[model samples]
Target: MDSISSRIEKVNPSLTLAVTNQAKAMAARGEEVYGLAGGEPELDTPDHIKAAAIVALQEGRTKYTASGGIPELREGLAAKLAADNDLEYEPKQICVTAGAKMACFNAILAVVEEGDEVIIPSPYWVSYPEMVRLAGGTPVIVDTLESDGWKMTPEQFEAAMTPATKMVILNSPSNPTGAVYSEEELRAIGEVALYEDIVILSDEIYEKLVYGETKHVSIASLSQELYDLTITVNGFSKAYSMTGWRLGYTAAPPAIAEAIIKIQSHSVSNATTFAQFGGVAALEGDQTFITDMREEYDGRRQFMLARLQAIHNVRVVEPKGAFYFFVRTGDIGLKSQNLCDKLLSRYKVAAIPGVAFGYDDGIRLSYCTTLDILNEGLTRFEQFCREH
Candidate 1:
């Protein structure tokens, strides 16, 4: 057989999926296992959103649509962006994508070139660095301090920049750490991007999942200049519990949006047709369900944090948003992968190793599972730590 493309060699399999799959394999063999590795919400999609998809399917809306998306969904997304994020855009500037992950990848490929440098904060989502690599860009990682809440400061951003810098990827309510950037913090970083003339790919998929007094702010909404240089990515996955629907959208300048459309026209084309209808309903329907889900996640976050705190020698930064807690395992004298392996093999508790997300000092656990499962899994984790 001929050798595969070199670009494929640069990509790494997802560490999160690795841990989850191992746990599943063990369960199939009749061993007890609890998975705390996935990022998807456990709740079912709201009825109104499902009903919209059903109505669309019954009306024969399953055929192909425009490469960008149906006009209705584009308009709905523009309205939602303006109302919620305070960022204005026309339907022409929005592109519906297969998921927020695709939106981010498309944006990176649309603007980044070979030999270009893309700055990503440390403890990032697993896919960010790989996506940059597949686009032929160098992933310049800037580490965020745990004492500073695992957020990138302007000084750190300045240090990471070089003349080859092409883009900066920002994920608020970060997947691994769940740290959110404040408006002041975002503005400081925004100023540097403006001065350096670099683009910002802002991933706000978890915007509506924030808890308590922590508010979600869009960096693009901070100023017109920032909006002009930003491609804002969001979707129905976290907020609407619609991961299976695979609907996400990006709001960008017209030129960048056209570039993304060109890529999609030859790629997967549009997001699912009936799924787009569900997306519209997700945005326009009653939002009370979102509030209820947020409250539930808040309770879970508190419960998980308290449990982890009771475990001696483990260090955890309380996550402000998202459903994850990235706990440092350095005190236990094991690398992240070894700790995760021990927890899964000996303790039957599954969590993602931090090395998968470009950090090696910690492992990530998702609190999206049931409380009873969390109690049992966490208790086993505590026991394992003590025994080792």
Candidate 2:
């Protein structure tokens, strides 16, 4: 066989998906498994959103859309940004893509190049560094501490910058860690990016999943200069439980948006046609589903937090947003992967290793499943810790 491209070789398969699939396969074999590795909600897509897609399909709305997306969806997204996120964007400055993952990749490929550097914090979403590598850019990972709530500070951002630094990726309500940046923290970090003229790829896909007094803020909304340098990516997968719909969009400055559109034109062409209609319904229809989902997740988050805190060898920070607990398992004297491997094989509980998120001594346990499952999984997890 011919050699694969070197660029492709540098990327790793998503570990979160790997763990989820393995757990699913085990369940399919009729083995009992408690799954806590997936990042998606267990809820079904709302009826209104599904009905809109069905109507579109019946009307033969399967034709290809403009590479940027259908006009109505983009307009709806612009309005969504203005109303929900406090960021102003025109429809012309938006590009819809297959998923939020694609939106992030497209934005990275549009601006990143060989020898350029992109800053990512530790315990980030696993794909961020890999995407940068695929774009031929170097990923400079800065490690954030548990003491600071696992958040990157403005000083840390400034210290990580260099002449080759081209961009910084921020995921508020971050994956793995579930750390939500406050408005003040975002303004301080935005100032650093503004002064350095570095582009910010702000992934707010979990924008609606925050709990308690926690709030999601778009760095782009902090100021016009920050807005001009930001590519704000969001989608319906998490908020509306439309993961299978494969719809996401980016709101960027005109030049960056044009670049992303050109990239989409040559690549996926556009997001699925009928799916865009579902996206429009997701934006314009009743929003009560989001609030209900958030409340349910908040309950689960509390349940898991209290349970994990009671375990002897485990340490966890209370996640203010998102449905995950990035627990410290290093105290048990095992690397994350080995611990996770044993947990899945012996305890029949699946969880993602923290090494995948750039932290080797921890593991990410998601609360997206039911309380019964979480109770069983954590019970087994506690037994495993005690034995170790």
Candidate 3:
């Protein structure tokens, strides 16, 4: 038995999956659990998207197409970006990936060399630092103050940058926090990146999932130069209820895109064929499903935020978009993992400990579940807070 690779050794198992697995194990033992740990939407895929997959299967579009993606799907994704974000990209500049996760990883591996730093904003998506570590890069995390709605300042970005800086990763409509960056804030960050010649990996998977009229501004849309430097990653998972389909795409410089395709060529080849057809429909089909999902998520966000706020000593940001509330409970006099374990074992509700997101005093709850289930889970958490 040879030694395991240090790259894998340096990483911890996904904390999100760890909690969800424990909840599942408990359920198998007959304990009821409402899982707020998983990030996928509970809704079923729309009929039209499913129909597209069926059509593809019947039409014998089952073999491997291009490694990056089907030509039509790639062109449609590029056109969608051009029309929606005011960013122009040819199909060659786009790479459709297995999922947004792979899109991000491919982009990082393509452009970042080992020992380079990937600037991550704290309370970040669970995978950012871990992936950077796997890529043999230093993860430079910049903290975003609670006062600024969890957005990093230009000064913070500057402080994190160094001679070895390669890329800065940002998630608008952030996964754990649901904070959307306003145009002014993003523009400030962009200016700093431009002056420094640092690349930006803007993960905008939740672009269509924003709430209350908040518009998502892509940094690439601001200038041709920024577009050349920014790799904007998005997918059908959050917005189209297609997480299981495993389809994601990125718009990047053609050179970077080609580099990622080289990486993809040796790993997993291409995404599922039928899933790409479904992705085509998702991009071109009716957008009403997206609107409806956003409306529903807004309602769930309100309910969960209000309930969490009622718990004494708990600090939760009112999220503007996405379906999560990263609630800080250090004030409750317990470490976050202990608190989450108590809630899961005692109250049978599952949430990810904030330590998973680099904040040990809080826990994260997803509002993507059914309203009844969400409200019940909230009640259980509130009761746990009252008891503590």
TM-score of 2: 0.99
lDDT of 2 by residue, 1-388 (tens): 8589989888999888898899999999999999989789999999999999999999999999999999999999988899899988889899999999999999999999999999999999999999999999999999999998999999999999999999999998899899999999999999899887999999999999998888889999888899899999998899999998889889999999999999999999999999999999999899999999999999999999998998988899999887899999989999998989999999999999999999999999999998899989989998898899
Pairs in clash, predicted candidate 2: none
Q: What C-alpha lDDT, on a 0 to 100 scale, does residue 74 get in candidate 2?
A: 95
Alpha carbon lDDT of each predicted model: 0.92, 0.93, 0.89
Work out the TM-score per prediction. Answer: 0.98, 0.99, 0.98
Off by over 4 Å in 1: none
Instruction: Tell me the spans in candidate 3 whose CA falls farther than 4 Å from its real position.
Output: none
Ordered list by lDDT, greatest first: 2, 1, 3
For each of the candidates, give the backbone clash count.
Answer: 0, 0, 0
Model 1: what TM-score? Answer: 0.98
Worst 10-residue stretch by lDDT in candidate 1? 14-23
Clashes of 2: 0
Q: Best candidate per TM-score, number?
A: 2
